[model samples]
Target: MKPKASPKTDQSTVRQRIVDMAARLFHQQGYNQTGINQLIEEAGVAKASLYQHFKTKDDVLQAYLAQVSQDWFRQVERAIAPLDTPKEKVLALFDLLKSFLESVDFRGCNFQNALVELPPAELNTRQLIRGHKTKMSQVITDLLADADPDLAAQISLLFEGALITSQLYHSVEPVNAARRIVERLL
Candidate 1:
């Protein structure tokens, strides 16, 4: 006889689907605005199932943050892997951001946006944001190990400022502006 299928047969992928939906909704709609009911309805999971996967909305936020950190860094690393110079890697960062600025999903840095939703005393959320920024800084550090410290700092500042300006103006001009700054630094 074949094994019986349960109503919860979708359990295997339910959590991942929930996390993915939450990430998308949180990024596109803003964390403060997305609600638990919507997360379940969109994920196609029952309320019990959502609760089973995540104790609270905050849990899902953490999962989304983790996913963003991992996905963003992995992409940046892969995008620069074929390049041969620190300058190339540094410039490539803007190229990557340019694509993001053009994408329909553009909403600035997720970590930075979350700061508006989460209180400063929210340790886990704050740490995740800090950790993401630190990793980004390390990427620049590794890429510019032999470059001038001032130049590295300037590039980092431009990269960050570009994200905000691009989001605010809904234009790639900020990225272009940052690229120009980077050229002068180099």
Candidate 2:
């Protein structure tokens, strides 16, 4: 018989399962509303097991944000990688948002959602959220090098506004509007 798998492998699977379950719950519900007890219950892990992996509830939330950020970055980069031009890449960003809105799991932007209840002094999570936005804005900045210096900032606002507006109206109209404006700016 083949050698048995190490216990570490199984433990990692449990950790990943917990993170995955927490991610879904946190998105479907609100971060402020998610509790550690609920996460343990839904994740099907004992309190001791959760503590062994995550020091605290905040740690679990941070871990969820970290994982989602990685996935989101990869998704956007992949979606724009084969585009014909930077303009196409920029527009493709809108397309990405469109798909996100159309998804059955559509929740407001995770980074933005995480910051909702945070006090002004919450720098770690704020920095994490800012980093995601900055990278996204850099894509716009790279694509619009010849435009106004503030164009990226403007587009960034429009980009964020689209997410909030879409959430407000429960429609993708705002993303389309932002795309039109971006097209004009480009």
Q: Relative to the unseen true structure, what is the Cα RMSD of model 2?
A: 1.8
- As a TM-score, model 2 comes out at 0.91
Best by lDDT: 1
Q: What are the per-model numbers of colliding residue pairs?
A: 0, 0
lDDT of 2 by residue, 1-186 (tens): 888878898789788988998888888887778888899999998888899998877777778888988888798889989987767888899989889877834477888888886779878778888888888888778777877879878988899899888877888999999999998878
Q: Candidate 2 clash total?
A: 0
**C-alpha RMSD of each candidate structure in angstroms:** 2.5, 1.8
Q: Please give the range of 10 consecutive residues that has the lowest summed lDDT in model 1.
A: 4-13
Compose the digit string of candidate 1's lDDT tens values, residues 24-135. Answer: 8998898989999999999999999989878989889998899989989988988899999888888998999898767744588888888789976789888888899988
Off by over 4 Å in 1: 1-12
TM-score of 1: 0.91
How much lDDT does candidate 1 score? Answer: 0.87
